[model samples]
Target chain A: MMRGKYVIAGIGHTAFGSLPGRSTISLNVEAVRNALADAGVEKDIVDAVLVKYPTSHFESIYGQKVAEALGLTPRINCVVDQAGASNIGMIGYAAMAIEHGQCEVALVSFADNPKTGSRAVFSRSRDPNAVFGWFGVPAGYAMVARRHMGEYGTTHAQLGAVAVACRRHGAQNLRAQLKKALTIEEYLEQPMMVAPFRRDDCCLVSDGGAAVVVMSRERARQLKVRAPVPILGFGQGHTAWDVAQRPDMTTTMAKASAATAFKMAGLLPKDIDVAQIYDCFTITALMTLEDYGFCKKGEGGHFVEGGGIEFGGRLPMNTAGGLLSETGMPGLQLVLEGVRQMRGEAVLQVPHARTSIVSNQGGVMHTHATLILGQP
Target chain B: MTDDEKAAALRPPADPLGDQFWQSLKEGRLTFQRCKHCGNAWLPVRSECPRCLEADWAWENASGAARLISWVVYHRAFHEAFADRVPYTVAVVELTEGPRMTSNIIGAGDPEALKIDQALRLVIEPDFGLFVPRFTPV
Candidate 1:
């Protein structure tokens, strides 16, 4: 079994937010270099390189491009695209590749310059729906939020609580992009970009990159790496349907993903010490909490209220600000935070956190991946 | 130019696979694919049945009956073409035949009044030179 056999030996990232002159490739290479340094290893140790394709646009042989820039001729090199879920999904793939003897140490990285490069890519009209005036990713989540509200009386204030918690954590993190602490009243006061979702409910537009070094525990010990966080479990689930066609908008594939991860780890949700949930939208976080089995389905609104998910609360979540407050570079940052929490080196460390779980979802909850990390 | 003329100029790029569905809209009918083998139905014009994966499917005309599953009011238009149309309602409407499609809920005096599962009637109207299907409260 791959469980507990693989570990994230190192994590690294570039300065988030606007980097006007830097290209996505440079950001990716820099992040990889830092990750290798953090692991106390040279570039030669990494034989496999998997990268998430840049989200703003597409490029053929993108993973090879990143690998070529890094000057690595890895045994296995390719791009993984599961939207936001690609980061955690790459870790899982790397583990399988190691087990199959395809590669030993793998480097997984993602870089995007959506903020300064092409914010318009996200705003492009969707097929068939654009004529109906339906546009943007937030609208899809807003529709889900509205349905959740109708079905279970989820309130805007409850969503505000999620934003408040992430921003509160972000305020404590100097590295975070939007670190201004937000109150519920302030969140509610923000202009509604989409009905049921205020500006505060949305994640930042960031131009940044993140990378992680995944290697076997045996390899880490051989290299004498410090503080290698063990990968207890990893799983992925995808709905593969448009939001309108989903069987139920309130529930997501996270349910299946979490179940698989928990089963593989042989640990329940209650055993988790900290969680770094993908918070592309406040509603996404709220819904994910429910699907991950932290709270009963339809009760997520009540679960996150009153500092419930804050650092000192019952379950500290998104300890590094998450996509909501951290650099909105997608899911890899959360995995980085999970590793730090497991290593007890987090800036906003959850005291005595032994086990940390992270989630990455993409495409309006169409794809989901769960990673359970723990102190080795 | 008038607003209607300007709106009509923004047509969707042609797709051969969806020609029949679009043509049906121009003919004042809404059509969805129904699997002839497994009795499944779906929207947005697919070649095969999503459920049974059967190539045997036929276009079934909708009866203009549907229900609002969920909706969002865009306070800011993502597309520059829709910048002037901010504060518009986009919705997921489930047709009686079991296919759900993304559409707009028109004729609602106030979008805030919209509720899940509200009864709606199909309204085929001119959009970007095509009679696209939309919905309004019955």
Candidate 2:
């Protein structure tokens, strides 16, 4: 079992938001350089390079390109794509690789330029459904929000609560892409781009990169890495079905993903001190909390209301602003925040946070990954 | 552009496996696949049964009966072809025969007037170059 045998020795990221002139490769190299510096390790020590393929576009030999740009010839090098769920999943794969003696000391990273690149990719016509005018990722989530509202009496205000909380936390984060604090009334006033979702309810389109370095606990101690966060547990689950084909909309793969992680960690929801649930959309966060057993299914609406998710609430969430307010470059950033919280160095630190759980979901709830981290 | 040209622009590229379903619409019928082994049914054309993984299946005609499962209103068009079609309703509807597909609800004066499980009937309307399936309140 690889459980608790691995440590995330370093974490890094480039500036989020609009970095117009920088290529995705440059951003990736910069993030990897920062990660190497953070881990206090020489570039030659990295024997494995695992990259999450860029979301905006695809290129052949993507991982090798990043590796070449970093001037490394790692023993194991490849690209992983689970959409937003890839980063944490890659970390889990890295742990298994080390356990099997395939390679040690893996660097997992992701970079994208969606903010300045062709965001039109997100709006492309989905085959079959495009004829119905259904386009863009938001419409899928909007449909979920509408269905959630229909099934459980989830209100628009309840959904808005997630946005308010994330943005409020983001305002304190100077590096956050969106530093503006939002109120319930202001959130309600935002025009609806898709029914059941305003712009506030959606994630930011960000141009940035983030990465983490993983190595065996023994190697981390040998290297004397600063603030190595133990990878207590990790797991992933994928539904792999279109939203229309899912038997139920409210429930997601997070249930299976978190179950495996919690089982591996021997922990429960109440034991978690802080969480960084993916917030690609407000409804996703709400539904994920329900699936993770943070609250009863369909009661997530009430669970997040009245500052239930903000600091000092039952469970502090997205302390680094999450995808809603932070960089929307998929989900590696949330892992970084989890690392920060476990190390007691987060910008908006949760008091004495001993356990941090982070979730990464992608493809309209089709894929999910869970990671549980603890202070080393 | 003429109405036919605009509709043709919206036409999805042809698919060999899905041709029968689209051709059935052109012939004034809506159809889905039913597994010969498991009695399972589904939409948008697939090679094998999703439930039993059996390639043995046949096309079954729908009875022009369905119900609204959920829907969303687009305030902005994501596709340039839909630039003039903003503020439209897109929905997921389940045929009474146990197959659900993504479609649009038409003739519902206000989209807000629609509700979950509202009864609907199939309407094969002419797009620019082909007949497409849509739904409206029964």
Candidate 3:
């Protein structure tokens, strides 16, 4: 098993919405500043930096780009890319670096300004091979949702239930871009972006950033940062990048990753107090619940309809608004929200929340990454 | 772009790597992947031969035969481009060779009609475009 004694000293998040004036670099700096302040650690103490950038569309060289912006360029810095899992995976790298005594303090940050250029679901074209020429990201996810409904007798209302719950949670979060409460009725009436996925079922594009600071447990005590959350476990898996190459759309490789993470953390789905499932699409969250073992196979829609994720329900989720309602700069905000619940700062905070789980699927439904955080 | 123009544009431009793969589809030939060095049979085409990393390879015609391994029916289109084709069947077909290739299984869209280990033959869709190497029950 992997060994690490690293702890998250502080986590910070910017408002989850469009900030047209904020450059990607500026967003990174803002998040880093807040994280450092929260950590109560002097900037000079930060030994190294890890930055995640999905494409050159956001930043040219992630390490140098974020370093120059944060004035930490001279310090040891490197970039990490596992596609959309970069943010969550960087947490693992940052924690490892501190555990190895390679760095006393490691700052991890990621942000995107989707508005700078039009980056939407439909705008993206297929790869050159053209085997997947018929569909894009949304189509790939749509296929899975459709199959789930056909196999399990899941209804559109069940899908709407997931969206409605997230919207209810988002309404309480001032930082959420789509804070207005959404009704299941309104969700059903919303225009369809792709069949089985209404406008509200999909995440909003946003311009924002998120950051977290990792250090040794000893350093965390000295810093006296509020309720330090230990990184309990992290797991990652990938099957294929293209939709055409995937064998089964109904199941995700995430199931295996989630199982591995549970085994490492010595925790089960029922042990989680809060779940920040990536809500790129409402169906994504539903399928992830099943894949993560939160519910029986093909029972995620039923589980969601049972109100298991609402504020007062069995599990508090996306307490700060999910990617569906919050700013959708990839899924860094989901990680930020996990830390929020762990720190008891969530608007819909679970009572005595001490443990939380965060998930992210990058490059369609092909890549899966998860992280478990607990207040020790 | 017009549908024809879009289809033409969608077609991969001639390249040293994958042009031949696309070229064979246009000729309605089900190509079999062969190792550049050992001349062993391969299913899915790769940039280099697994046996020898040799970039040089030739495209040969196959019997266009395969068997269905698994399938999923998509009742909703996820993108505007696919909205018209709301429901479709996507499957992984095990070719006679070792490799398995993913493609749409057409003819009867119902899940029961699409059985596992069912024999299928590749059918070329010329007008609908994209040289879809779809499968029909043999």
Candidate 4:
């Protein structure tokens, strides 16, 4: 089931921060049109529509709503949900649709007015088991960091390094919300959102949208733009929905998800030139690096400490400033950044980057997605 | 009430699925479901056992002993009910019977009070008319 069958033809996004006047529809319209324009494809040619699941209380029947807003009657349309990991899942589904002869061109879009929308937790209903005190995403990730610290002796300074690195990259990203520089000491001094996680360690709460166009490699070659990024590998992994039920809090389903993607692409971890691993919190990023085999278990601290995760280091991660500093649009931006890197268009490009991988998670590290992209 | 106010008013409501668990806590005992067929124990009790997927199960109280796995101190209040209770500590404690739960580590409002593998004893406290299980160092 190797898939050179699909390629990401184009990517587009809005200014990725708090824009008070924008609604999800308006944002989707802008991103969708930009993606279509970038792909050099007409709106009518995109016969399928796929979207990421929103944590927003303001939107519903997202795919159909977006399709109507754009005035396109796609042959197949739907919203995919893996929480924050839905971006890769949308791409995977789009590829499946093409392979099945369902659609020739697919438009994948994600938009959320998180900054303007009402705030709430990820869970729709509270589980009695979490009655004590669950502070949403921050708390969920803090427990993970605490466990890793207890088991592997990971330090707060090690977590601070992730925040510092993301901000360093964000400072160059014009579209990023928080473009200011940060040192490990400054990151350490930020207010603690939850224990083991400071305010700087968490991703920004922003309002924005991003979209990508996925089509067959054959169609991509026919376009006027340069060669599209090939969908070398894409896969999803879903584990326990509740944190208490997770087999191991330190490790996530990314192990299985990344293994599938790598096997499909016939590539190894060393082949990746850049990564856009999700950074909801500094700990999740560190754990994702470990879980995805970027480093040995319990060595993520050592792996990222020596200016290693920065642009010029061993593995340039979150080159789009990630969810941490760029925008909290979650999974979609990771894919957008991956495509940007492969196209040599990243603001903080990893030199000669031809192959890349992006990962995003949902729930309390419950669902995971790993996608690999390369030269057409 | 406004939307935020309504959202703030909502607390962790017990469902029928976990009714037995809530009741057991009210009785000053921490109980979990054990499958009669395969002898596997689990918490947040489901109708069927997870390991063997059998509906045949029995309720048993834990030894009230657990080991501290990890913990966090929240400096932000997520809900209006907890607005005044900012900067609280919540920990994951695994029972000696082999099930883990998210509860508070009392007297350890400070994250430094937590130690991995430290022995802790279970205590039940009433919150919003429901008795919830919490843990503290032994």
What C-alpha lDDT values do all the predictions have? Answer: 0.90, 0.91, 0.73, 0.83
Displacement of the residue A256 alpha carbon in candidate 3, Å: 3.4
- Error in Å for residue A130 of model 2: 1.7
By DockQ, rank the candidates, best first. Answer: 2, 1, 4, 3
How are the candidates ranked when ordered by lDDT, highest leading? 2, 1, 4, 3
Measured against the native two-chain assembly using Cα atoms, what DockQ does each of the candidate structures obtain, in the order listed?
0.77, 0.79, 0.25, 0.60
lDDT by residue (A309-339, candidate 3, tens digit) is 8888887677777877877766778887887
Sorting all predicted structures by TM-score, with the top scorer first, yields: 2, 1, 4, 3
- Candidates 2 and 3 compared by DockQ, better number: 2
Clashing pairs in 2: B7-B128
Model 1 residue A38 CA deviation in Å: 0.7
Identify the CAPRI category of the predicted complex in candidate 1: medium
- Where does candidate 4 stray beyond 4 Å? A58-60, A122-126, B1-11
Query: How much is A31 displaced in model 1, in angstroms?
Result: 0.4
Q: What does candidate 4's lDDT look like per residue over A280-310, in tens digits?
A: 8888889889988889999999988978999
Cα lDDT tens digits for candidate 3, B28-88: 8768677767786654567777667787777677777887765555455533544456566
Better of 2 and 3 by TM-score: 2
> Where in model 3 is the C-alpha error above 4 Å?
A1-4, A54-59, A120-122, A129-135, A150-153, B2-4, B34-44, B49-122, B127-138
Pairs that collide in candidate 3 are none
Residue A329 C-alpha lDDT in model 4: 82
Residue-level lDDT tens digits of model 2 in A29-64: 999999989999988999899998889898889999
Off by over 4 Å in 2: B1-5
Model 1 bad stretches (over 4 Å): B1-10
Q: Reference contacts recovered by each candidate, as fractions? A: 0.84, 0.80, 0.19, 0.72
